[model samples]
Target: MHVVATAGHVDHGKSTLVRALTGMEPDRWDEEHRRGLTIDLGFAWTELPSAGTLAFVDVPGHHRFVPNMLAGVGPVPAVLFVVAADEGWMPQSAEHLDAAHALGVWHGLLAITRSDLADPAPAAAEALAEINETTLGDVAAIPVSAPTGSGLDDLVTALDDLAGRLPQPDVDAPVRLWVDRSFTIRGSGTVVTGTLPAGRLRVGDELEIPSLGRTAGVRALQCLGRPVTEAGAVARVAVNLRGVPADALHRGDAVLTPQRFRTSDVLDARLDRTGDDPLPQHLMLHIGSAAVTARVRPLGSDTVRLTLSGALPLRVGDRGLLREPGRHRVLGGTTVLDVAPPALTRRGAAAERARILSTLDGEPDEHSELRRRGIVRKDELKRMGVPVTSRPVAAGWVVDEKLWAELRSRLPDVVARWRQANPLETGPPVDVVRQQLDLPERSLVHALVSPPLAIRAGRVVRDDTAQVDHLPAPVAKAVDELRARLAAEPLVAPDATQLAELGLGRRELAAADRAGVLVRIGDGVVLLPESIDEAVRTLRTLSGPFTVSDARQAWGTTRRVAIPLLQYLDRHEITERLPDDRRQLR
Candidate 1:
């Protein structure tokens, strides 16, 4: 299905033309029908010969309700611009044209309404010339009188041609349905209607309001006023939400897939000023059915930073309009460059940021964006409409693959240097590595050092340098002397004072123990590596359970050395400790 919104001055026969074409009343409110002026949005659909099914979103044309008009046309891709032959062009016509142009609506049909009252040729020519000045370019114009039904067939044919040329909606893209209407039904609890330009909505799919962070489920779905299990893009859909209240959702709110979009109040955009005048500090921003008051800060000649009063779910390349608050006249058009912009608080930061934004204006690819930002969340990239065509280097984080490769290549050397400086530590802490690499996320550092370097007990250690192989020559000779002395007198171990004189301190003794050259039984007591085996062999020669005194007599060692050895053997499961402090083989 294809949807098109109406645009023109008030009393230009926009509603009348829609009623004649679709044979359905476009005005839903009695006040509008009685006053013959559309104050709110109205909807109708018809079947065309060339386009199959087309939906019409009839919008109000009064200056007081221009916000309502924007709500109707912002999500719709095409427009049906109306003009009265007798009126030629009016003030509202120019404003509507400016709005349509700023919104990037290029596909349209021009209708010279009430042509029976005046010559249609001259008015059609003038409207075409006006449209040519804006982004609509040259559009097909038809002279039609709703009362007489003259030239209605040609208008339908022209619309059919436009619909056939409309671009196909991306059904696989993330859902961002702007709710233009929300109400409650008798049987169904809450129903919200909007144009689904992309993505799919199913009966049981979970959706969220980006600004509010409120979640709801699709209990039912409707498209073109008919019930359906699912609805695709480019169709007007009414979703019956299960959990959300009708009062919580407003006309400007959006329903989207959870986590696919983010709400942001600050935007970095490219602004094309309609005139040469400098923009005001405050203006009305219109985008995606939302009218917000925003503060504008010009970054460069064509770039700006907008701080909105409220958050909006916006993406890169989205078009919006900035209008004066009182006059509501469009000052310029905007193309979103960055939705999640950095805060410019440093000295000369705006100029530097503007320079950076100027580089991003050319539509950099995903890799270039990641490289510039150093790190980005997956959801943030999706919200910016960036395509993730390749796998990320880390989970939920995207880094420049080239940068990751360089960091990975240097990890081993970095770890080796860190170990050389801090030999007593097992490895460098994870935070230290992250700081050294100047990475924004710790997960990226872990990913880069995963295979060649391993994280053991929360420290980064290289696989090749994990073991302490060769100590200093002095420590190595001291370890050999200690081992030879323990081998000669297995039960007699050196004390701390004697070992300190030999230059074998606790650190060197621990290193020797790790290297399997000595066994540390207690504080300052070192034994040969095979001391446990020889002691166990000798203990078996004794009878049943033995006491600490019996083990000391059997090993010819003092009670201090004998007690810790029995405990170590018990810990290693070589012997069991009894309730009376006796030991038995296990």
Candidate 2:
């Protein structure tokens, strides 16, 4: 299915041509038919020769309803540019053309209406020349009087050709349905209608209204007024929502795939002029079905920074139009360049930013994207419309190539400085490195480790350095003396007085424990690793459950060390304690 919008001046027979083509009234409101003019948007559809089902979004041609007309054509792709044979290219005709061309409507066919009133050849030739100057390069112009139906058959053929020329919609793309019309039904809750240019929508799909920070379940779907479980792109659709108020939604709101788009009020765009005039500082922004006031800051000759009045779900390469608020005309067309641009804080920042923006086109280039952002999550890069094909340095984290290299170069020095200040420990913890470097993920910190720097027991260290080398010389000597004394007497534990005499303070003892020189147990008690091994072996040889007193006497250690050691053995499952206060080796 395909959708086309009718564009022309007032009383140019746009609705008449649509009514003649579809046997259906394009106008929905009674006010439109009473005044014999289209006020708001109108919709009608019919099956064509080669085009399966083509829908028409008939817009008002009068300058007063220009905003309503823009809301209709802003989302539609192709157009049926209408011209009256008697009146050649009037004021509203030129404004309508400018609006359509600014919104980047490329596929279209011109219809010369009222052919019976005047010569059709002149009107057809002039409208085609104006259209070809924009993206709609060349198209067939068909002259037909809707009343007399002179060339209706030829116009149908041209419509089919235009439909075939339109690029196929991507069914797998993320859904972004701009709500053009939203109203409540008596039995069914709220319903919204919009043109689905790309992506698929299914019943019960959870969708988001980003600007409002709301989520709704799709209760039902309709395409061309037929109820269906699902609908695809390039067709008009109406959605029944489960959990929202009809009054909360408006023309500019969009129903989007949750987490798939970022709603931003500030964006950088590349502007292309529709004419030779300089773009104004303030304009109206028309995108999808929404129009909002925009304040523009010129970044370069063809680039701009727009601060929108409302947030919209935007991505790179999306096209929109900039129009003067008062004039019934379009100022220029815009292609989004960046949705997450950096802030300008310095006096010369805007100029420097323009120089950077000059290097970027509207297309999403991964290298240029990463160069500007330094690092970003894979999910956000996808939302920004950048394709990330390279392997992530960490889980769901991508770092720029040059930035990764710089991080690698800085790691060794960072570890060295931390170790120097903390002489008793190997290095700073991984989480500490993450905070110091302002990295988002711990896996990213691990990815920065290389040969010289290694993660040892959760702290970074030199791979070639021995564990004792991380301590000061005096602390190392103290640890060696304590180990020698424990080696002579297997179960003799040191008291705090003995430790202080050896100058092994709390930090020194902890450093020695980490280095595997000693194992700390109860308060003021320290033993060698081999001594614990020997004690475990001796306990198993006892036939019966032994009391703590019996073990203390056998090892000739004091009661203070023996009790805590027995409890530690029980905690580690090396021994089971009896109800009578005795212990047995497991």
Best by lDDT: 2
Predicted candidate 2 versus true structure: per-residue lDDT over 1-586, tens digit per residue: 8999998858639999999999888888888888988889999998989779999999999988888898899888899999999998888888888887788888888899999999999998898888888777788889999999999989998898888888989999999998889999988989999999999999999999886688999999999999999999988999999978769888889999988888889999988885668678889999998998899999888889999998899988888989886767788889999999889899999999899888887898788888888889888988887878867888888889999999888888888888788889878999988887888889998989988778867888787766777778999888888878888886878889999999998888887776666787766678888888888988877779999988998778888889888877888898999999998887
What digit string (tens of lDDT, one per residue) describes model 1 on residues 17-107? 9999999888899999788899999999999997889999999999988999999999998999999998988888989999999888989
How far is each candidate from the true structure, as Cα RMSD in Å? 4.1, 2.6
- Model 2 residue 20 lDDT? 95
- For model 1, what is the error of residue 462's alpha carbon versus the real structure, in angstroms, after optimal superposition? 5.1
> TM-score, each model?
0.87, 0.93
The list of candidate 2 runs beyond 4 A from truth reads 275-279, 450-452, 514-516, 529-556, 563-586
Error of 2 at 27 (Å): 0.6
lDDT of 1 at 19: 92
Pairs that collide in candidate 1 are: none
